[model samples]
Target: MIPLAWYLIFSAALFCIGLFGALARKNAVAILMGVELMLNAVNVNLIAFWHYYAQMRSTPYVHGLAFTTMVFVVAAAEVAVGLALVISAYRRRQTPVVDELTLLKG
Candidate 1:
């Protein structure tokens, strides 16, 4: 069986990449993508932990799976809302770069 540390390391790397993208990018869409990536990383961690702990207990793994599903649902909602706002901002301001949105007028 694959080791748990490997899964954790991979998830950590994914999270770091997402964090960097979110922090370094100026485009709202890119930032949203980064946020999605980070959320995915979190899902990965949750599944990995669930798998690792599944052996220790006889209980079903639905708890972790359900939580992961909820995370996905929330992420989708967040993406939809975030993109809608970005589109609205772009329509009014003509720029997707976040730094230009100082005044919430648009």
Candidate 2:
């Protein structure tokens, strides 16, 4: 069987890459994609931990799965709202650059 450490390492790398993309990207869509990547990394960790714990112990591992599901729901909602806002901003400013959104008086 695959080691648990490998899963965690991969997830950590994905999370870091996502974080960098989110922080360093200038485009709103790229930023949203980065956020999605980070959320996927979180799901990976959750599932990995659940698998490890469920096998080592006799207790149920539903909590982790449930939490992961919740994260998916929240991520979906966030993406929907975020994209809507981004679209609105793009319509108003004609640009997707994050730095150009200084005037939120609309």
Candidate 3:
């Protein structure tokens, strides 16, 4: 059986990579991709913990799975809304770069 520590390490690395991508990228789409990656890392950790918890309790509770599903739903909604805003900004500003689309600047 794979150890929990290994799963945690992998998830942490994935999350850090996502964080870096989100912070370091200039494109809005790339930032969205990074956010997706971070959400996936969170899913990984949730599933890992759920598996361990089930093993310890010797029961198949579905709370973690349900929470993960909700996260997926939320992530999907976020992407939809975020992309719509980005597209709107791109249409108005003629650019998708995060630094250039300064709609908030008055």
Candidate 4:
């Protein structure tokens, strides 16, 4: 079995990469992808901790799985709403670059 620290380090690295992608991009789609990556990293962490906790306590784990499922649901909804807004903005502004949007300046 893999150690808990390995999973933690991997999740941390994944989250950092996602953070960089989100912050260093001008395209709205790319930013959304980055956000998704970050969400996935969180899921990995949750599962890893859940497994370790169950092993240490000699009990079955269910709460972490439930929480992770909720996170997945929330992420899916976020993607749907985020893409819809991005598409609407693109149609109105003819650009999908985040820095070029000024629709809320009024």
Q: What is the clash count of model 1?
A: 0
The 10-residue segment with the lowest total lDDT in model 1: 97-106
Best candidate according to lDDT: 4
Worst 10 residues of 2 by lDDT: 97-106
- TM-scores of the models, in the order given: 0.93, 0.94, 0.96, 0.97
User: Ranking by TM-score, best first?
Assistant: 4, 3, 2, 1
lDDT of 4 by residue, 31-79 (tens): 9999999999999999999998988887797988998999999999999
Q: What's the TM for model 3?
A: 0.96
Of models 1 and 2, which has the larger TM-score?
Answer: 2
Candidate models: Cα lDDT each = 0.92, 0.94, 0.95, 0.96
User: Can you tell me which runs of candidate 3 are displaced by over 4 Å?
Assistant: none
Candidate 1 collision pairs: none
Across 52-71, the per-residue lDDT of candidate 1 in tens digits comes to 78878888667778889999
Error of 4 at 6 (Å): 0.6
Off by over 4 Å in 4: none
Model 1, residue 45: C-alpha shift (Å): 0.5
Residues 1-106, candidate 2: write the lDDT tens digits. Answer: 9999999999999999999999999999999999999999999999999988899888776988998999999999999999999999999899999999765756
Relative to the true structure, candidate 1 reaches a TM of 0.93
